[model samples]
Target: MTETLLVTGASGHLGRAVINDLLDAQKVAPANVIATTRNPENLADLAARGVIVRAADFDDPASLEKAFKGADRVLIVSTGELDLKSDRRLKQHQAAVAAAKATGVSHLLYTSMPNPEPVSPVLFAGDHYGTEQAIKASGIPYTIFRNGWYQENLFLALPHAIASGKWYSSAADGRIAHGARDDMAAAIAASLASGSKESHVYTLTGPQAYTTNEIAALVSEVTGKPLEVIQLPDEALTEGVKAAGLPEDFARIIVSFDANTRSGRIGMVTDAIETLSGRKPRTLKQFLEANKAALLG
Candidate 1:
């Protein structure tokens, strides 16, 4: 029997990657996969491929429950809501969990961050931590993918920094590892389709961890660009981004990532990717080499 696999946020990058892995690599039948998105029309390609596409709006509980019906495993790709003043995302996740339990889903999965603790400088920690706790309390076997930062995240700062020949940072001697976003998706698809009933927590990460200085050197080596690493204090980091035209609140939140890095909350590594997917993850150097054109432009 083909188990029904419902993936939320199907229109997003990660969700689409997971569904593609399921169909192309995992060899799961298309009829067994349910792709849920707020706009069903965005998944026309998936629907054309015989995937069961449904409309699911996280903010509306009734729609979530309706979309969750008759699924064996459901992957709640964490919502994109990041409101600074409210718990909108956490509430949405809790509602999804409730809907899953009510619909009799056997296995549940969630994509979360590395360290979602109260002491972590990142304000969104509570949102993920709360969602994980909700899944545990739902009385269902669950798989929690504590996903780390992505190598593509470098695009947010590296290109601009390399262009100017200087990279600013508040992460002092802090090390961190980043998984390729698509590789993480493949590992997740493998686990979801494995038909396992054991509850587990997997921290999917890159093959190695690198500090700011090390990554700067790697970037310089890869692009042959003369890049300088400028370490700033937390306050200076916030002020720097604010001066760069970001709002003060958003700047502070962005600086919190550096503070979290400095605290070493996200530097851990694991073999969950290969262990689950049976494939080696791409290295940072390879990613840089492949995307060098985009980085330079």
Candidate 2:
């Protein structure tokens, strides 16, 4: 009997990329893979390709158990919700873990963040930290992919900055080790599809660190447009985001990321990506050049 691998959050970008890597790069048989999501219709193409598509909602224990049944390995993609005060995310994660355990899955893999300290200002780190602790206490064989910041996050801020010729941020002069989202996904897929026996925690990061100024310079160089990095007070940054029509809570969380980046909390670079994926990570310049047209327009 072939071992079945179930991947949650299959409709999202990272999840879909992992599925593709499992099939295209790892040569995993599609018949032995299960792609799951809350909405099953989103995975029609996967189902048509002989891959099992199941409906799995973290909020519903029965759904997760059903989705996880007959699975040897499971990858729990972290949910997108960032609200923790209500404890909804915690409940969802707990539900997934409980279902995995009850369904007798052999190996459990989780997508987590590089949460060195629990008190770091990164808003979503706490959720990952809590989930990691839960997985440890569960006594199930597991692997934790502690992913670092994504270089694409800069693109989210680029369009507005390019339009105004100024990149506003609270990351004054500090650098961040931002890895590509696809690299992180590929690492997770490779580990899951590998024959490794022991459980491990892989800290996925980029090979080099770059500051906001350096990133802005890359944008300028790629687009041939002058761009200036403007450092702002954290409170002012939060206020500016709110003034631009973002929710106060969301703006505060984004500004807090700047504070964390500015304090050198996310500045550490590592060779983990190359070590795991056996290929050098895409550099900031490469990323900028590839996405230059989108960044400028």
Candidate 3:
């Protein structure tokens, strides 16, 4: 009997990419891979492709149990919910762990962030840190992929900055070792399929760290548009994000991310990605060049 590798959040971008990498890079048979989401209908194509499709909602214990049944390995992609105080993500992670334990899953893998210190002040980092603690206590053989910032996040502010001709940020002059999301996903899939039972934490980051000004220059170079980087006070940045129509709470959380970056909290670069994937990560210039058409459009 072939061992099945189950991946949650299969409908999301990272999740879907992971499933593809498992098939393409690792040569894992699609028949032995299980792709799960809250709505099984979303995965109809995957089901037709011979991949097992199941419905699993992090909030629903029974659903998770059903989805995880007979799985030898599992990968829990962190959810995107930003409201940390509500404990929704905690409950979801708890359900995943409980289901894994009950089903006798051999290995559990979790996607997390670089939380060198629990109180690093990144709003979302706390949730990942807490989940890591819980996983350690669960007594399950696991791997924690502490993913760094993604270069793709630049898309969030790119269009406006391109049109306005000014790059605004609260990141000060601090640098970020932003890895590509697809690269991180590939690393996670590789780790899951490798079948290593020892608990490990890998900090996946890009080959180098670059500042906001450097990124702005790279964007300008690729798009042939003039751009100037403007550093703003954290308070002003938060207010600006809110004025631009983002919810005040969500805006504040993003501003906090910049503030954390400014404090030099997330500036560490690593060779972990190359070590795991056996290839150098795509640089910011390479990323900008490859996505220039869509970025300019």
Candidate 4:
């Protein structure tokens, strides 16, 4: 049976990758996929390829209901709003869940965080937890993918650090199983294509875990740049990032990742990616090597 797969946030990085994996790699028929975004024009190529492209805004419930219609499985990619002052992201996720329920979607998949705890320093943890609760309460058979931090996220800080020959962090010997975003998207694409009825929770992490110091060493090896990991107090770390011209919200997010790592909340290593996608997850080394040119600049 060819089932319709509705992927929200389709214009974004993860969403586009999942759709591509579904159509090109997973061999899911393009006609069976629905790619929804705020601007359908962004997905014109997908539409040209026979994939159904729909306009669905997270803030627009009626559009979500329309876009989700007739979908067998739907993936509600978590919204990117990080302003803790507002509940917009949670409301958007809630809207997606409600739309899925109303459309009678067979199974729903949600991109979540690893160990979404209320007390965690990761500022976005609560938003993911709340979304998970809403999915459970929706009485929908679902797959919850607790995606680990993206190895590509290193680009946010690595270039600047390499230039200065120092990597600043407050993680204090903490490790992270940073998986590649594309690999997680592939896993999600595979799961959606399988059309299985079982409800499962997967903690998707990298093939191996690495500490901040270890990553710094790898950077030094990869780029021949003597990068030193500077351990700073949390307050000092935040101030440093802010002084480097990062917005306070983003600076706090970076610091919180370290704080969460120090607490051992982001270091859970798992084989869930291979179990789901029938392939080993990409290593941080592979990711770094592939993007070396970009990181060097």
In candidate 4, stretches whose alpha carbon ends up further than 4 angstroms from where it belongs are: none
lDDT by residue for model 4 (127-156), tens: 999999999999999999999999988888
Tens-digit per-residue lDDT, 27-139, candidate 3: 89998999999989998988988899999988889999999998999999988777856878767887898999889898889988886466787876767887888888889
All candidates: CA RMSD in angstroms?
0.9, 1.3, 1.3, 0.8
lDDT of 2 by residue, 178-286 (tens): 8888988888888888756578998888778888898888788888888898899998989899999988878988897888888788888877777776778888788
TM-score of each: 0.98, 0.96, 0.96, 0.98
Model 4 gets an lDDT of: 0.92
Model 1, position 70: C-alpha lDDT score: 94
Which model, 3 or 4, shows the larger lDDT? 4
Better of 1 and 4 by lDDT: 1
Q: For model 1, which pairs clash?
A: none
**What TM-score should be assigned to candidate 1?**
0.98
- lDDT minimum window of 10 residues, candidate 3: 115-124
**How does each model score on lDDT?**
0.93, 0.86, 0.87, 0.92
